[model samples]
Target chain A: MTAMSSAGHSRERHALLLMLSVLAVLAILHIQQGARPIPATVMLDAVLSPDRDAFDHFVILSLRLPRASACIVGGAAFGAAGFLLQVAMRNRLAEPHVLGLNAGASLAVVLVTTYQPVVLPDILMPFAASLGAAGLFGLVLALSALGSGRFDPVRMVFFGIALSALASALVSAILILNEDTLEQLRFWLVGDAAGGGAAAVWSILPAVALGLVAGCLLMPQLATFSLGESISVALGASVHRTRIAALVVTALLCGSAVSLVGPIGFVGLMAPALWPRLHQRPSLGAFLLVAGSGAAILLAADILALGLLAPTELPTGALTGLAGAPVFIWLVARRLT
Target chain B: MTSRSADPPTRSRLTAEALSVGHGGQAVVQDIELDIFEGCMTALLGPNGSGKSTLLAGFARLLPALGGSVRLDGSDLATFPTRHVARVLGLLPQQPPVPEGLSVFDLVARGRFPHQGFFSQWSRQDEAAVGEALALAALADLADRPVETLSGGQRQRAWIAMVLAQETPLLLLDEPTTFLDAAHQVAILDLLRDLVRRHRRTVVCVLHDLNMALQYADRLVFLKEGRIRHVLTHPSQCDGRIIEEVFEMPVVSLKHPQSGLPVFLPCASRQPEARP
Candidate 1:
């Protein structure tokens, strides 16, 4: 048994190493793409040493690096959030986008950005988004809990879809009316990484860190949740406390991701869903792998967004949604069959 | 009460005091007082809607008391930290949903949840406990196999091993032998009996089979209509009257030819409707 477990441990380490290496390569590729493509060596030099006079170095330092960082960080946040939500709800399709969290954040950002007369600081966007995500999630919980007095996964999923549609309609109505905000919010609405540059990344970083920390802390208890409610409780896990903590952590992550890059979809769904292929089941190490896989997928999407149309950048969100929809269908088909 | 003449002195590990348990404010088991003795397998026997499972759930702290308290070691069971209680009392509910692709060892190792911390790594002690539990449940050879692929008996044993891995002194099982073959039922019952006698674990389990309960249990608790009807310390003390009243069926009490254990055979009732 010990030998077998040690072998499994080594296999996990190898998988982790491969995942990190792929992510590193993706990050490099992400930073390398632009109108004027810079060589990898020049990018490396620009990062390691100070050469502020060079335009390429400045662009690498200012533009590409931060954009890549935002994509990675935001994607990771979404992945962790999705993993938590899926575990909590015991549904594979439970992600920020499906659960109305992203839409809620988008609505809040739009309301705060376009509706207000005063110019709000960029840092407040994540806070506004967090509030919206948490509020909408709470509403979803209450709505689902209405008939059953418990959070039924199916009911919660349906409620989330319905609420997300309503929230999306509200956002479209506000955007269509305010044409001035439309042009400014258009790229963000489609989940672009261009606006996130550095300041946006910095603003959401603390929240993401805090969320990841809380997720790590709650994972041991959360793992037992798969044993079903009764067994989890019998194992001495405080099911209620663990569940609430999972939700709060998810809100923090989804809110941060939404604020960083307008509500990107599918990373959360795909990352955790694809996790078992990398590892046999959910574990603490699998948590990090899920987060890393999320980062890699989003970064790859962003890279495709930058280079797909060659000077004409596409929306990262569109690409992710386009890629994610089929995967989502496959998941549903597999589950139903 | 009738066979107190040969009863051995025993300590009570769990004591329910005026305990009332309910669902959604409607009490199913009300104002119940019961004592679960240490190092004994006490089978809870009652008909459907008699709150047998509810009483078991209450003792496991899975349900909150409506009015009174359940005392564990002379302290209110509700007062102890849930994890603390878990380390002392393990429960195996009927139909524990096993996740797909979960190996038997992995499933059993999860029983160490209460003993683990956030940063404290899985230690040799945890591994040893899991191994001992697997060995005890006779699942060591199938440790690497997924629980879903196991036979009904092996799967049930895996679940039992998980609770055993908790190392709890008190175990509450709800119908551990349900849906198993006759041989498997006897195997599970014998295992529970051995757990009480050999390991000195206190057990309170709800059982549907009257003969099985009578054969294995050191004590029998009969509940009916949200109340405990009788507590029989010896199999000889279980008369047909209590069984008939609790189950609402006419039964004939007979002695087993080989073991001389009491057995109740239920009299047939109305037949099923004619099928097309």
Candidate 2:
């Protein structure tokens, strides 16, 4: 028994080391591989001791540094969020956006900024998104209770899909009615981290921190819940508590990214899919690995986005989608079969 | 929240008075009274859809009673907080889902959740409890094997091992030997009988085999059409007619040559001499 536990411990440690190294390399590459093509030595100088007058220093410090961190922070949170959502819902294919949280947040923001009288700053958008996600989640909860008082997995996912479709249609209608800010809205819709960079990353930091802390705390409980509701209840665990914790952590992670960059899709799905491949069994360590690899995946995607289309930077979401689509499709296929 | 600590525990050890159970606000069973004995094994037997599982669910407080209430040690079972009930009684479902890629030892260890806090470390006592449960279930050798890789009977025993690790005084099991072959069925029933005889733990299980229940359980409650038909205190006290009425199938009782326990056989006639 001691031998097996130690082996499991070593496996987790190996995953941790691997993900940290991968994140480090990708972060440096993310800063260096931009359109400006700063050399490795200059990138090191920009990171270590920035000379204020150097154009390279100004470019590295001002542009790529924040952009890289935002991707890492956002990706890590989403990775952890997706795994938690899957555990809560008891569905292997469940994703962070599977519950239509991003759709609710987007639609709420669009409606508030376009129709309402409140002139809010971009940073305050996450609060609106939080409200929207919470409201929609409540609606889902209430609707699921219509037939049975218990929360049914199929019913929850069904309502989420239907509501997401409805929200998307409403958003499209509002977008058509107000084409005046079409250019700005188009850029926001595609999801990029270039414009706000460092400021946006700092805003998202608390959400990421909240998600990481909460995810770590709630992870063990979530594993116990997969045994089914009766066993979980018999074990003295309140299934409702696990569900709420999952919702709160998911909301923090999803709201942080959607409000900042509109929505970065598929990092959550891919990170979880990739984590178990690195570790033999699912544990807290595997969860941490997923979060770390999520950051790595995003940073790598963002670097490609910046360098792929030279002067005109591509949207980070599009690049992740391009890489994530085949992988997501493959994962879904594996699960279905 | 837990009950007021000042109040003493209930008097009737796990009693249900005027119990009615329902799913989705629809009552399935109504007006049932039962007293579960401590330090004994009780078996619930009924035909398919006779509400055997439903009654167990009510006793476990998994379903709300349409009327009446369940009490443990004089305290209302529903009134006690979830963890408080769990500390005393543990229920193992018919086919509990084994987590993906988890080993038997780890799965059994998960049963110790009630005794643990979110911040509590895995203590030596927890280890001892898990080790003992695995040993009891005859699964100590397969402790390292992933649960999904185990055979149906072994997996069922593994689940029982997990519930044993919970270390609850009262255990309610829903069909512990459903899918096993006849040999394994006897093996599990023997194991459970050993539990009652040696450990003196209170066990309430829903079983399909009449002879098995007659041989193993100390008492049997027969239910038909969502109500208890009769309670048999001993195997010899059971009437063949009552079994026929509950199951809608004629049966005959035969004496086991060695143990002299009643063994039930399904046939057209209830006469003992209808053939072998």
DockQ of candidate 1 compared with the true complex: 0.63
Candidate 1 lDDT score at position B77: 95
lDDT of 2 by residue, B114-233 (tens): 887767746778888899889999999999898989999999999999999998888899999998999999888877877766786789999988888887777789988889889876
| RMSD in Å for all candidates | 2.9, 5.2
**Model 2 — TM-score against the truth?**
0.91
lDDT by residue for model 1 (B1-276), tens: 122224473788899999999887788998899889888889999988899999888898888998799999999999999999999999999888866878898889889998998777588888899999999999999998988899999999999999999999999999999999999999998888788777889889999999989888888999999998899888779888888788888898889886688899977666867879
Clashes of each: 0, 4
lDDT tens per residue, model 1, A235-329? 99999998888988898899989988889998989997765632225566778888998999999999999899988999999989988989888
| Residues A80-144, model 2: lDDT tens digits | 87777777777665665656776777778678867765887656667777667666766776787
Query: Would you estimate the TM-scores of all the predictions?
Result: 0.95, 0.91
Per-candidate local distance difference test: 0.87, 0.79
Worst 10 residues of 1 chain B by lDDT: B1-10
Q: Relative to the unseen true structure, what is the C-alpha lDDT of residue A82 in candidate 2, on a scale of 0 to 100?
A: 74
Give candidate 2 misplaced runs (Cα > 4 Å). A119-123, A136-162, A172-181, A277-283, B1-12, B268-276
